[model samples]
Target: MSRGSLFQRAPIPEAKFQKTEDVTKERDADGKKRINQYVVGELLGQGTFGRVKLCHDTVTGNRYAMKVFRKQQLMRKKDFQNEGPGRGMSVTTALSKVYNEIEMMESYSCHPRCVNLVEVLEHQDSQKIYVVMTLGEVGSLLTYDECEGTYTAPVPGEWIPASSQSTQCSSRSSTSRGRSLAIPEPIAKCFIKDALEGIAHLHEHGIVHRDIKPDNFFITTQGRVLLGDFTVASKVDEHGRVRGTEGTYSFMPPECCTPTDESQEYSGHDGRAADMWALGVTVWVVLFGSLPFQKANLKELFESIAECQYRIPPDAPVSPEGLHFIQAVLVKDATNRLTAKDALAHPWVSTADFSQLPAYIEAALKVKEERAKKAAEDASVSGSSSFTGILRP
Candidate 1:
């Protein structure tokens, strides 16, 4: 808990639960399925591996999100052969990725901005692993339809120029409806701040959350945003670099799309800077309700990302400060991009009024400032390179 030290891991207890069939069939007087000491209710959400269900502790009546991953599906060879992030991953590697997520969550359980893990349950016979976590009743930022509603078109009289050759590729519609709807400024600031806190926490521990899109950020019923879903997260090397181009294509940085060095299949990149780039894209998505870089074809999409071919619609409702913050983090050269700590000190986030901010946000802001100051002093004394290389006007 001390400043400058990595966040300590809280003990996460593992339990052997009842047989899956019995647990699913046995119902209490309330008509809810019994899952050991917890009563399982409706399904909350699902993913490629398994589904998350709402469950309550019989002893404490406290609600939690039970993430159930099927061991069989996880070990499936086809899944490993998929062309994306999981390509050519071995069975052992896939299973280890799940445990890594649990360990990361357990290690940072005490951090308010990161989701807390209560306990883990394994049913070997049932081929399932159950991870119990604090519930985000309001769901993820993606769950808020209002925040993703259609954007207002530019005024009729406004003279909007045609797209340049760099961005003239065919536009691909997002899977989500109303993908161009922008979240209000105040609300977007709060969400982005929460995300930065989570990112900073991971980076401070020498880890990088390779995947940091909006879907990974969950919102509690209390309106506090907690970052979750670490399936693809990884630890950085001593030099703060990580190998491989892991993450959603649209969120990946320019270097990830087209490696700076083509000699190696997977070149090392600044893990922390890659995270900041993803955060920048997340911010852009939340503020504009549309991807800054989009294309109908996969190759073209990657090309656009590598070229840093994106533009803010002239009618985007973002403020000058917000625009500056986005530009700062989304720099084409990762070396010049803002670090999560530096991002917290950016004018847009730093100058925001804290009176109406959530308690967690206020606390995170204070911690960010303290850490930024310490980092700056450390860099100066050791003549270490600062992540904030040069700010663009």
Candidate 2:
């Protein structure tokens, strides 16, 4: 497909929701809230602007997660102008982002590792929008038991040598939260591989998923990992650039935090490389159960990320290959950072046992390799043409 066609916005047809008294609580005789052909079930999750409800398709006998947005709440100017962490955008921008996410999900629905959008329903009269998507039964990676909570570094004198423990250990020690065990290396490898495959697919299409944290990755009942939540994702231009720094603060790359020109604007950066950095942080959180560079103060956090100053907890259990893989991805230099395909071929990931992984994962890897080969061939042909032009002149 042409790069221009990949991110083209398509208007979603509005579906009229069957009106009922108190739609949130009230149900029909069959004990469900009907919206066209979908039977809206219980509420699955609630957020600032809207809520997600479990829904069933009566005709297809399939289940989906319906995200309902209230137009009034979404249009509130005050919410978008707020100053702090959960900063908002202008009304128009906010609405466009919502639509953009729907467009992206619909455009890439066929990918095996991406959360697919089933349909969108809009209630003009009620001023609401419902987005139906495939359900990720296992929830997000962040909320899962194996990946949640923080890891406390070993006490200064306990893990490190007495001579240098005072400085090194204290710096690594964190009082953030109670400790939790990190995911096992083998299992973490599978999860990271899944994320890499999803990233590879997006990068292949000139799309960058700015948000690549654990919270955005979901797992299904069949044990397949799928990337979801693309509100801040954007397509790079012909020069491979994307403007602004739109992403979760903690997962953003150093370049995103630092302005590029005198105007104080971002001046655009390599969107694909930024994604790899986020994936690096995601991998760190999964294997270590904590962020590699984290601070309560935002300024300090940004400084740490800019300097690439992070230390592996002395007691953290990471193998040599895993450490090497993380180092390659988390490099401060964007140009030197490993791409998704390169990371996948690293010893840490390539050597992992995928014997028990889902069959679809292997299929996806094969597809990624084929696409990479084609991309390299195309680049070679383009280079040859440029050289021929130079000779003719």
lDDT of 2 by residue, 1-393 (tens): 012222332233342223332233246797777877788975656554567778888899998888888776666623242222233343344566677887766555457687777777775566778877777654555442325345321111122233332332243344412333355555567778887888888777767899888877876656567888777787777656786677778888988765344544334678888999999998888777778887868898888888888897665445668778888989898888998778889988887665544543343344435644676688797874211000000
Q: Model 2 scores what on Cα lDDT?
A: 0.66
Q: Give Cα-based local distance difference scores for all models.
A: 0.66, 0.66
Residues 1-393 of candidate 1 have per-residue lDDT tens digits of 012222332243342222233343378887778767888876767665567888888888899888877776676623232222423343345666787887666554457787677767775567778877777655556432336432221111011122221121123222322223344455567778887988888887777889887777876656567888877777777667777667778899998787343343443678788989999998887777667887878899989999899887765545678888999988989878988888888888876553443543333335435655787898899998543101000
TM-score of 1: 0.72
Off by over 4 Å in 1: 1-25, 77-94, 143-181, 259-267, 353-393
All candidates: TM-score? 0.72, 0.71
Worst 10 residues of 1 by lDDT: 152-161
Error of 2 at 136 (Å): 0.9
**Worst window of 10 by summed lDDT in candidate 2:** 384-393
Count clashing pairs, candidate 1.
2
